[model samples]
Target chain A: MALHPYDPVAGAALRNVPLAEVDSKDRSLALSRPWQLRPSLLASIASHGILTPLRLRPKQNGLMQVVHGFRRFEAARRLGLPSIPGLVLASRNLLKLFLQALEEGRTARTLSSLENAAALRTLKYRFNVPEKRLIEEFLPLLDLKENRRTLRLHLDLAVLPDALQQALERGLENETALRLSGRPEDFQSLCCRLILSFQLGKNRQKKLVEMLDEILAAASKQEVQSVEEVWRELGCAALENRADLTPADRWKRILALLRQARYPALSRHQARFDELKAALKLPPPVRLQAPRYFEGSSLEISMTVREARQLDGLARELKRISGSQEWEELFRLL
Target chain B: MQPYKPEKVFVERAVAESVITRNVLGNLPMAQVEWIDEAGQMVDKSRRWNPSIARAKQSLVLARHPGRFFKPCPAGTTKTGRRNVCCNYFVVNFASNCHMECSYCYLQAYLNLPYMVVHANVEDLLDELGQVFSSNPRSHYRVGTGELADSLALDSLTGYSRPLVEFFAGFTNAALEFKTKSNCVENLLQLDHRGRTVVSWSINPPTVVQAEEHKTASFEQRLAAAEKCSAAGYPIVFHFDPLIHYPEWEKDYRSLVEEIFQRIPPRSVPWVSLGALRMPPRLKALVRERFPRSGLPLGELLPTEDGKLRYFKPIRVEMLSKMRAWITAASPQTRIYSCMENTDVWQKVFQSQQPPSEVELGDSLLQLL
Candidate 1:
């Protein structure tokens, strides 16, 4: 096989380059930044300096571009080191250098979700890789399915704002973030804020996003120029932004408002059921449960007692409840 | 309606000399045809294409079905493991995918093969059916060709109905039903069906036909075709299988029922089937993705025990009961049956009468035929 003069595997050699000559600003091939470096890594670098050499290619302007070690270079930079060891490659092929750096980046550590997007974006927009090739070749390389849908989703994630990308790194789901990426910037900001503040679980996060999307899609165009206005119109704005309420309470309130708006009939039935159950005034130990979605015409009654003596009182309460008018009203609700 | 003219056609090497292949290729003089060693590879690769399901429909495949062609109707037992009061119906799948794009088509999620396939080996299908039917002379089998594909959607190209109609005419123990949403009845108009083939249309209100049933016949076109079939001595049936619910559904469905009775003689209408809109949950996402402007996904749907989503019980009951009332008011003699519904729904819709058993229902329909 033909070999180039600046082959990264064969021709590359380690050299100590000065911090001034090494340009870390050009991160066109970087998969991740050094934003949240572990304190252990910082202490290691502080004690022993950089143990591994960074990959750098010489630019035409005579400055060495950091190719694969932004995190290590950043550690040395913060430690105030004069110079760091790096492998210098003089290849004229920028794409080859980028791929070499990508391989080295993968070998060093597992790339975060956002870093995967970054690598895909660099291959796509920067190198002008065709979508078909990305879907077939690069997606599998990045541990994703080989399909146009996966490619589009990664590309969409790559283009979101930095805050949203960081949120993805910090536990926001890829699918939920992708759904938000297509919406207007204001809407994305609002939803991201809600998601982070509430500390919602995965299911609640998905439900919140889906409910918001459905409500927005069903709104009249002229009436909903802004998502905030829709929130205000639906009476969720004040409840969500209430300072005294806990995050759980706020999420519950917002979800209730959205559910009521989205499914008026189902919510109305639920409200009536709640009212009838309240009117029944069953004993605290006894519970009356309606069927799911009121899909069936049956109701369940259960009682929890700490002692056997409580059963007599519970049975008397149940007997009284069976003859109550509210019991019939509850059945009618079903 | 625009005639289905696929941009390309893939013909498997095995079926290159089949009659259905020859007829279909002969009909499509403008299509670019490619011969492949096998159909499964090409159909499998088609799913990887961009906009997989929609793009797959732009091409057609004429291949031999490599498996059994006859099976019991899957609609009898839903995916959720709840068995409905199923008519003893059988399905003869002559095709794999449908060309007409309905927003709520189960094929969007149910079928792994995205491209439309026409099984060209009709003689094998006939021979298998002959053995099954002749072996059981006392058993009456009610079979349909519309399980996986529309019965008459590709009739002009494949000309499958002629052979099927002629074959079924020779069997006194079997009846063939050509269920479709298309008005493509020209092929069956002159066939000697001999009181064996029942031409059925899956009818909806014009509003639904316009909004959801893309690239299919209009209400008037289907009614006209049904009238023509009745005049040609074939029994006619209507299926309101997916009775979509909306604010004005009652008025629209009532008008639809009244118009059918007003035009065609109700005596010729042996039975009409009512089924509410129920689909696998995955199909809901596909419908929402394909037809964003459609209101189908916005309805009040809940997951039933069958693992398919349907309108809430009261909503379904209201829609089906009102539809049953309208049809009964139109023609008291025409029988009404619920398709894929439980005993409770049947009792409510048929009020005061007991729900029929599967054998009883199947036998009653066969007796009418």
Candidate 2:
């Protein structure tokens, strides 16, 4: 359903109007945010500023439907502007007008508060819109240029992890949220906790993603059925990407899963414990796993390089534990 | 008053203020009194050119610091200091200023001058070199004289390269590098072609040379100079050290690498150092504030432990991987290094696995020398 310039914007417009003095109409606000608000979009918008103005129509409720300035809208929002100038489009007119805008080389903002992959797919099929146009053009066009630095088509995909893509749906434009979608269920919560825990440096964040990519890439390239197999597959080169993650965190998680105990995905916790023990001149006794959303099925370990010493240790421990009578009864049937 | 008559020049240097010389000494190597001729050039009054004591003293007084004067270089690290990174190295400054003013240069932050400051006391400089090299003899000392000033900037006047080339000759363990953006190869070409001294050039993508690095020789001219050094039996070095992080960086770097190997055989080239465009921390804001059109993006940046903002580690890793892949394919044996980076990167891109400590790096490079 096309949003009538009368819907959200009209809803926003009439939101503050007193019932006694209110009429339903859309109004536009003129705004531009500070240049730094957009990490990589200023130049594009400035280049865009040279192109053309967005055409938003006015409704009586003082809300405006964005006909353009998708870039400018985010910029203004970043700068804390309440209302932005936008051309209002009634629900009845949005479908044809949107087609006309594209035909005229006049693109509207990528987002019109009408983002839902299911809806977009339906819209694409019904309108015969190209999938690429929806992803490469319309999506980015809808976002204010400032928010586009880290925005990509994944946010438009329904199959991505629900917990991970929540921020994108809430209009929070950040790469951290986008990256978490790829994590197994076990690490999804861990990723968010880490983002909120420490000030993650850009390099740190990039390295983590690259490490995950390397793992995924390795899995796609080879066949593996066992932990040992995964280790052998990773090779030494690919493991360096995860070198920064403490060994203890890595060890404990695999052990806890094998032991059927809850585990934590963040290795930084182990690193902290190690750091304290080191300062105190005490030996690190054992790995600690903080139970949250961790489970072995959530794991997507691959042939990317890793020392896998802990995995080896776990195998040895499993052998010793199973050798005992307490372990014998556990797997006696299997 | 035109000093070098009959020679048309785009820029000229004059005596801004001088205090070192009580009077004039007529024995200075690259200076002379001249009168203007019909071609708007300088004609020397004397038959022989000599720099007087007065001239050397004048150059010194002009270069004096108004305050404490000495601050360590922020983004300055040699292949040795940069050891365990994409390379292991360090750089030193034999001169303090440059006469050429490229709009992109950071010399203004270090020196208080518009004129070149050639260290007149060769003995004191030798003493400093002696102390450094003696203490580091077992290590390969890959040091360059291009930090505070263009290593070859004042060679025409002071003839500093002659002594430097001679100085590094005895210190077989120390690799003395003289880097420049100028084609002042005349003084350098006469050296003994010792394997120790690397005649390096700080070049950029061609159009960058024309636009930002003003008064510098063209890319083709500089490559020809490298070719000349190669023919002299001297191993030459090339640096795209300040590889600008432009929108078209991939195209620019690829073209440069292609041009270099195509023009000068990879064997004749001693090494190539590919550094991302970086500057001292102080200069970042200054450059942005002063040159509004700098247009340099915040490109995958991070602050070093030492505090210089740089291309973050992953970005650097990605950059080096691409660069090393290209170079490794192009000239497999030629040594490639990075300036002032860390050890993890060295291992990742170069496949070094285990890099030497700073001292070990110095010894290894020196042994090669």
Each candidate's TM vs. the true structure? 0.88, 0.44
User: For candidate 2, what is the TM-score?
Assistant: 0.44
TM-score of chain B of each: 0.97, 0.73
Model 1 over residues B127-182: C-alpha lDDT tens digits? Answer: 99999999999888999999999999999999999999999999988999999999
- State the lDDT of candidate 2 residue by residue for A1-334, as single tens digits: 3333434433222222122221212212212212213555655554443233344543456644554344455554444444443334444455565454443332333422223333344346556666556656655554423232223343345335555445334433345555556445544553443333333455555444434433433343345344333333434223323456665454334333322211121333334433533443212333323222111112121222246886576555545543554323322211
Best by DockQ: 1
Candidate RMSDs in Å, in order, are 4.4, 20.2
lDDT string, candidate 1, A207-269, tens digits: 888778777777743364578889899999999879999877888888899999877778888
**Model 1 alpha-carbon drift over 4 Å, by segment:** A1-25, A33-55, A61-64, A69-88, A91-110, A120-156, A159-163, A221-225, A306-309, B47-51, B352-354
- TM-score of model 1 vs. true structure: 0.88
DockQ of each: 0.40, 0.01
Candidate 2 structure quality by residue, lDDT tens digits, B73-173: 33434422432242345555555656554555666454433334443445556677688779866645667778787877556655667777878877776
Any residue pairs clashing in model 1, and if so which?
A: B80-B306
Every prediction: chain A TM-score: 0.77, 0.30
lDDT of 2: 0.50
